[model samples]
Target chain A: MENMHLDQHISKQFNTDLEKLRTAVLEMGGLVEGQLADAVKAIETGSMRLAEKVQETEDEVNQYEVNIDAQCTEVLARRQPAASDLRLVLIVSKAIRDLERVGDESSKIARMAIELSDEETDPDGFVELRHMSSNVQKMLNAALDAFARFDVPAALKVMREDKHVDREYKSAIREMVTMMMEDPRSISRVLNVIWSLRALERIGDHARNIAEHVIYLVRGTDVRHISIKEIEKQLDQDQ
Target chain B: MENMHLDQHISKQFNTDLEKLRTAVLEMGGLVEGQLADAVKAIETGSMRLAEKVQETEDEVNQYEVNIDAQCTEVLARRQPAASDLRLVLIVSKAIRDLERVGDESSKIARMAIELSDEETDPDGFVELRHMSSNVQKMLNAALDAFARFDVPAALKVMREDKHVDREYKSAIREMVTMMMEDPRSISRVLNVIWSLRALERIGDHARNIAEHVIYLVRGTDVRHISIKEIEKQLDQDQ
Candidate 1:
């Protein structure tokens, strides 16, 4: 009976540890989301101050990754968690990396914002940029929500959203290429916009990766490098 | 005495597992290197067949990542490795991700090669592409060598080389932009070259990431998001 009591206590403590880790990851996700939003705003509004703020927040975002990684290592070493607990740890670890990369893409967008602010604002790609940013932001938010709720269906939706984002990205690039050819003088300035749009597209990719991690966590299936159609088929069969 | 023998057998098995994991990562690394080289060759020589071959190998590279990831997870769950062993598993998990991304970048370059082959071959940016690809490839090779040997100094050197690659990438982009401005008709073709150069530069970044993982595995330090000078300072202090 004493041993049983001890085991219960240890297991409860382990659960608390995992919960804390999940909370930390969510906090990191929130921070990255804000950075991305600020970056897009900086570009749209030509706010140097906002862009600089986004750049300055990069170190803080990186620190979160380092801290969470250490916490994960501690939990793995101390608890040796298995099954779902193990999956949770692995998911958190991989998700934080994707979040950190989103932070990086945000920083790149912020840098582009700074460069664009230096030049005469060319409205060639702003519409595309704004449209794509909104879509990506929604995708990221939905991905995090799915992660929090362990919603496999929501994650699958995010994956589908990624394909939409890719199409949007290609169309934007095509439009920009035509614009650059039409007006050679706008080439340099439009290039900055192109880069920013590229960064936003990459952020969407990271969000899709996060969604994939969530599906893997819930289903214990490796969904990476697989088609969304195939993933959907597998999930439906599992259900 | 019987328990001690069992302990010895388990420890031996754990060691063997770690060895196998390391070997697998190297194999994956080697495959990615081949893919990258072929992609570069396809671009330089305008070989559509080589580019197609590179695309076909991408699935193989992704499969390697999945297999190695599963092996790492299995080792962690079964052995519950602590200290250095735990670090090894973590490093392997992360390094394979970088490797898989490198493969993705290679595929992107190969696609560009196919596109350029269809267009009139403009010799504007191929020189920079070749130079940057070779540098990035060397960086990746050195990083993998460092990982295989656990050589911190070699890893540090790879990180430094990454900075050099970045400089080359920037100069290449500047040159391409100038060429595009001078010959607006060449804008579309030059853009493809620019994208390939960007992919190579990103590959350098991933190589630097792999080197950072190697350093973390050996020194038990988190060297990410830190300046190279800072990393060197920390290493000197440790020594």
Candidate 2:
């Protein structure tokens, strides 16, 4: 009976630990997603206030990262999880890194927004750059959803979306350079827009990283820099 | 007798493992340093050949990074080191990350050099930026020396040198912007220089990261983003 009671206590503790870890990661994901949204909105609407808010929220995101790191260390020390649990811990560890990079991209966009305050006019800045932001925002939202649901298909969709962001980013850079060539006065403002778009593209990559981690967590394989068809084939072969 | 034999085996294995890690790191360091120097020369002398060499060298650096990562894992699994050893292993992991980032910066500079061929300006075009690159190269060299000697003072000296890089980086941005404004047609060529300097600033930062890891590994304390005086006080207090 004593042994049975002790086993019950340990099992309960392990479940609680798992739950805590899951909640922590989700909370971090939610905060980072919110920051990404704010960053997009800041650049989309040219809202310096929104940019300031995103900058402020970075502190909270950093704090969450620190807390999650502490929690991972504590859980590893206390429970000594094996196999699946160990894999979960490692996935979370790697996910935190991706999430932190996302936070960096957000702050970088906010910085561009702040720099945008001195801007005047680029002919099609909004139509071109904000369009790219929308695509990147979609990728981020999908990545976060896949992370929440552990949906491999949704994760794959996000990975596919990154190309659109990258395409738009390069196009935007070329367009901005031409604009600066045509009018030197537009240099700073156009550069600011180009920088924000680049940041958005980087944020899209970070989202893809999260999706890749989600795929790895569910499938025990990495899908980085690989096509979805290749990943699916590998998954099928694994079975 | 068994315990003594075990100790002898452990010591022998530790020596071999440390040697492998050190050599890999030194090799990566040397390769990245050469890449950066070649990248700057390519930019200065308009040598696509030099740029191509830097690109080819980056592959070797990437391979070194992969090998170091596996070695770190194998070492960790074989010898569950404690305290100082643990610190050393973690610091090496972080240093590897820094080296990889430096490789990335070198590649970026090389790419800029490749792009420069299409828009070659007067040879006087990159004087300021070339000086910035030289400063970055010097810092990187000193940082590697600091790592080799485990000299905290030398590492601190490298940290203090980041200010000069930053100062040059900021002034170069201003000068580049002015040049673009003065001649709108020059925007494309000047943007490449701006990007190259930005890459150099980032490479210097990676060197700083390596220096900080060195300080942490030897002292068991994180000195990142903190002042040299604080690091000195910590070391003094420790002794």
Candidate 3:
């Protein structure tokens, strides 16, 4: 009877620890999302202050990555979870690395924001960029939701949206280069915007990586660089 | 007697698995190293055919990465290794991913080689480009050796090499843009070499990443994006 009581206590402790790990990771994800939003705002409104804020936030993301990695190690050592549970902790650990990378790219965008603010590109020229930003922002939120709910289909959709982000980025690059060629006065400003667009596109890629991990955890398959249309066919076959 | 027999079997089986993992990784490393060599050769000699070969080799590298990942997963499930054994498997898995990325970038170079072949720019004008290609190739080889022997000092040297690669890349970019501005006829070819330089620089970065991961596995520390001077200092401090 005493041994059974101790077993129950240990199980409860592990559950608490797992919850702590999940909360810690989700918190990190939230901060990255916030940085992305702030970076976009910085670019749109030409706010050096907001850009600085996004840069500062990356340090926190780095700390979170370190802390989460250490915690996952401890849990693996102590809990020795098998199959799904083990994959879950490992996935979270890897996903947080991607999240931290997202923070880094977002911070790069913030730097570009400051540079562009100094040069004064017209806000009108940033409409396509702003639209791309919103799309990536929405994708990030949906990805986080997919993680929170363990919703594989939603996560898959978020992954699919990354292609749109890439397409928008290519168009942005072409447009900005043309702008630079046509008016050398705006060259520096347009270049900074192009850098920011590249950063945002990368942030979207990392967010998509997180979504991929989420789906991997829930579905136990690798969805890396695979098309969503094919994935849909996969789901149908699975069911 | 039974316990002794079991211990012997476990040790023998563990030793064999470790040997297998090491051999597999080394083999994959060999293929990737060859691919990188071809990429540099293609660009340096301006051989579109060599570049095409590198691009074709990427499919083989991808197959190796997939094979190694599967083997690692199977080993993890079957052996459930701990301590150094666990670390070894995990490190190799991560290494394969890094190598595959290296292959991807080399393929990018291959594409650039084809583009440059069609470019009208005088191939004789790119002295700095030739030097940078050799530097990147040397770094890849050194980094591969660093991985093979877990040589921290060698890896530190490889990290220092990356700064030179970046500096050369920027110089090449400046030179190319100047050539383009001086003669619009130079745009297409100059841009192709610039893109190739960018890819080569990134390849150097990925090599540095592998070297850092080697340190991480050997020493359990993350030295990403940290200065080479500091990394060298840490290695000295450790010794």
Candidate 4:
């Protein structure tokens, strides 16, 4: 009965700590999603104020990362969770880093948006940019939702959607390069678009990484450095 | 005496495990440094053989990351270290990821080198690329050496040198853009150069990240998401 009582106490403490970590991560996820959305909207509408707002939120996001990191370290040191619980802590820590990076990437796009708002508008590629931005935002939202629910299928879908983001980025780059080659005077403006597009592409990568962490947590396997086809096969086998 | 013996045993085991982890990280670091060297040489000499060699070493680098991650997880689970020891483990894990990514970036440069080798070599940009590559390699070496010795000054120096890499990258991009604008016929080749330059820039960023991890390990302060100026001020106060 003494052993049973000790196990009960340990289990209760671990669950409470895990819950706290989850809440903190989700709160961070929500803030990052907001920053990403506002940054994209700023670019779409050329709103300097909105862009500045996104930049201002970066400090808050950074604070979340530090706090979440501390919480994870505390949970690890104090709780000593093992197996799936341990994996949860590890993946939560990893996901927080990716989320923080998404925030950073959004800040980059916001800075570019602010700079581009002052220049003459070029609507030629803005439509594609909006499309790509919305697509990436969707992936991030899905990945965060999957994390909140621990839904592996949702995470897999997020991973698969990243390829679409890549395709869009390539086509956009091709278009931007062609524009720059056609009009030398617009080189600097087009270069800003190129940099902003790269930021969006990197944000997509961070979202994919979050989704990968979710899969790793649930499947107890490392799917990184492997082909998506291989990952799909493994998922199928697990199913 | 019984309590003292238990404490000694735990301390010995933790020290042994940490030493093992450090050796694994250093081994991974050495392989990554080799890959970076070969990748740069391939670009400089336009040698497909050297590029392929870098590609071959990628698997070995990936294995090291996997092995080191397992070791860290085991140490956390079995020993449950706290305080600075815990921070060391966490920072070591983070550093290993950065080192692995540096390997990935080198592979990217290698693939670009192989593709560019088939085309007529442009010696004009090759000189700049060589300079940037060597500078980045030096930064990586310094960062790894700092990690090995836990030397804060060397890490700070590595962080400072990243600005030089950035200047080199920007100048290279400006030259490439000018070349593309002057001769639209060379757009494809110039695009390749742009991609290669971006990869090198990313490598410098990874080196900076490693230096930041070293700072976190030594000073127990998170230096990321802040300006180097702020970090310098904080370091001065600490001293």
Candidate 5:
């Protein structure tokens, strides 16, 4: 009876550790989301202050990743967690990496915003940038939510949305090329806008990667390097 | 005595698994290097055959990542390695992610080569592309070599080289912008070259990332999100 009670106590402690790790990851995700939103708004409003704020927040995001990574290592070392618990720790490790990269893309966008704040803005590229930004922001939010809930269906939706985001990115690049060709003098400025658009597109890719991690976490399937259609078919077959 | 022999046998098996994982990663690194070389050559010589070969190799590269990742997980689950052994598994996990990304960048460069094969060649951008390509390729090779030997000094050198690559990338972009402004008609073709240059620059960044992983593995310190100077100081203090 005493052994059984000790086992229960240990199990409860382990659950608390896992719960805390999850909360830390979500907190990090929230920080990255806010940084991305500020970056986009800075670009739209040409607010150097907001862009600088994003830069400051970047350090915080990095610290979160480092801290979360340590927690994961501690859990793995102490618990030697098996099966689902092992998967959770591994998934958190990979997801934080994606989140850190999303933070990087956000910082790149913010830098572009700062560069364009002094230069004459090109309205054409911003139309595409703004559109793409909104799409990626939603995708990232949904991806984080899916992770929080282990919602495979929501993750699948985010993966499907990535394809559309890729198409939007290609069309936006084409439009930028045409704009640069029409006004050669605007080449440098338009190039910066193109970079901002590129950053946004990459953010979408990172979000898709997070969504894939979520699917892997919940379904115990590796969904990377496969098409959304294939992933969906596999999930359907599993059912 | 029977139990002692059993322990020895299990330890030997674990060593074999770790050895196999390391060799697989090196093989994957070698494949990615070939793809990058082929992609660069295809751009320089306009060889659609070589570009297609690179595309074919990408699937193989992706498969290597999946295989290595599974091996890492198996080791972690079975061995529950602590201290240095645990760090080795984690480093391999993170390094493979960087390797997979390098493969993606190589594939992107190959795609740019295919696009440029049809268009009229622009010699100016190719000069910078070739220069950046050679530098990144060397950095990647050095990084992998460092990982194979667990050589921290070699890894540090690769990290230092990354800064030069970034500077070169910036200057190349500046030059490309000038060429586009001078010959607006060449904008489309030159843009493809710019993309290839960007891909090469990103490859250098990934190489640096791999080098950082190597440093972390050897030193048991997280060297990410820190400047090279800071990393050096930290290592010096430890010594």
Candidate 6:
């Protein structure tokens, strides 16, 4: 009976540690999502102040990445967790990396926002920027929510939504090209918008990465280097 | 006496496993570097067949990433390696991800090579592209060499070289913008070249990432999210 009690105590401690790691990862995800949203808003409003805020928030996101990585390392070393527990730690570590990259891309967008705000371009260009931003932000939010709930279907939905952002981005790029061709003087400003659109498209790619991580975690399979159709078929079998 | 013999055998097994993992990582690095060089050559020669070769090479690179990840996962779970061994696995896994990204960017450049072959742009632009490609490929080669030999100074050199690529990229972007402004009819072709330059810049970033991983692995430090001056200072202290 005493041995059983000790086993329970040890298992409970591990559970606590695992929960802490999960919570830290989710918190970092939330912080990245916030930075991304503010970056989009900064671009739309041409607010240097909001862009600065996004940059400041990135330092915190970086801290979370370091902290979570340390925690995962410690757990892996101490617990020697196997099977599902091992998988969880590995996935969390990998996901933390994806989150950190998302934060990096958000900072890139924020920097572009600051530069774009300094110059004036067609306000019509921003309508496309706004559209792409919202779609990507929604995809990122869904990815995070799916991560939180371990929802594979929601993650798959995010993957599908990334295509829409890609199409929007291509159109935005073509539009910018046409605008520059029409008005040569607008070259620099249009280039800034083009770079920002590129950043947004990359943000969509990062969200797709997070969704892939969620799928990897829940399904015990790696969906990377595979096509969307193959991923979908795999998901169907998993279900 | 038997226990001592058994201890030696277990240690030998671990050493073998660790060596295998390192060999795999180095092999992957070599393939990525080859693909990067081939991609640059494809652009310089404007050979569709060479560009297609780079694309096919990416499949092998992707398999390396998946295989290396599995080996790391298995080692972490089964060996439960501590301290330096654990760090080795972690760093190797992270570095493999960076290398895979480099391969992806190379594939992107190769695709651009195929597209740009059909269009004529300023011959001057090719000069800049060639300069950026050679510099980045050199950086990547140095990074992989450093990883193979665990050479921190070589890694530092690669990190410094990344800045040169960035400057070249910025200048290239300016050149492309000027070309677009001077001849609007060249807009589409210049845009393709611009996108290809962006990919080269990202390839530099990935090389920087690999360098940072080497620094981390050799020195037990996290040089990421920090300035180059700080990294230099830290290296001085470590030396």
Estimated TM-score per prediction?
0.95, 0.84, 0.87, 0.91, 0.95, 0.93
Better of 4 and 6 by DockQ: 6
Model 2 clash tally, residue pairs: 0
Q: Which rank order by DockQ, best down to worst? A: 1, 5, 6, 4, 2, 3
Interface RMSD of each: 0.5, 3.5, 3.1, 1.9, 0.8, 1.3
Task: Name every residue pair that clashes in candidate 6.
Answer: none
Q: lDDT of each model, Cα atoms only? A: 0.90, 0.75, 0.75, 0.83, 0.88, 0.83
CA-based DockQ, model 3: 0.26
Q: Taking the tens digit of each residue's C-alpha lDDT, what string does model 6 give over B145-223?
A: 8887778888888988888889889888988888888887887787777877898899899989888887877777888
lDDT tens digits, residue span B1-239, model 3: 00001133367877787777777877887887787778777776779889889988877888887677667666666777765566666678777877888888888877877767775546833687678878988888888788777777787789888888988887787676666566655544665676677778878887887888777767766676566777667767776
Model 6: how far is B57 from its true place, Å? 1.6
lDDT (tens digit, per residue) of candidate 2 on A1-239: 00001123358878787678777888888888888888877777778998989888877877776677557545655665654464455567657767877887889888887777656653347677678877887788888788777777788889888877788788888888887777677787887777777778778888887888787667756465367788878877876
Q: Which pairs of residues have clashing backbones in candidate 3?
A: none
Chain A fold similarity by TM-score, each prediction: 0.95, 0.89, 0.91, 0.93, 0.94, 0.91
Predicted structure 1, TM vs. truth: 0.95
Q: Estimate, for each residue in A8-93, the C-alpha lDDT of model 4 and write its tens digit.
A: 33577677788788888899999999999999889889888899999999999999998888889888888877767777888888
- Separate DockQ for every predicted complex: 0.78, 0.37, 0.26, 0.52, 0.75, 0.69
Docking class of 4: medium
Q: Given candidate 1, what's the lDDT at residue A9? A: 34
lDDT of 6 by residue, A1-239 (tens): 00001123358888888888878888998899888888889988889998999999878988888888889889988888876677778878888888888878888888988888777545547887888889988888898888777777888888889888999999899898888888878877878778888888988888898888777777778888888899888767765
| Maximum-DockQ candidate | 1
Q: Give the alpha carbon lDDT tens digit for every residue of A1-239 in model 3.
A: 10001123348888777778878888998999899989889887888889999998877888898788778767765676666666677677777877888898899888888877766336435887898889998988888887776778888889889988999888877786666566555544665676677778878887798888787677666666467888777766776
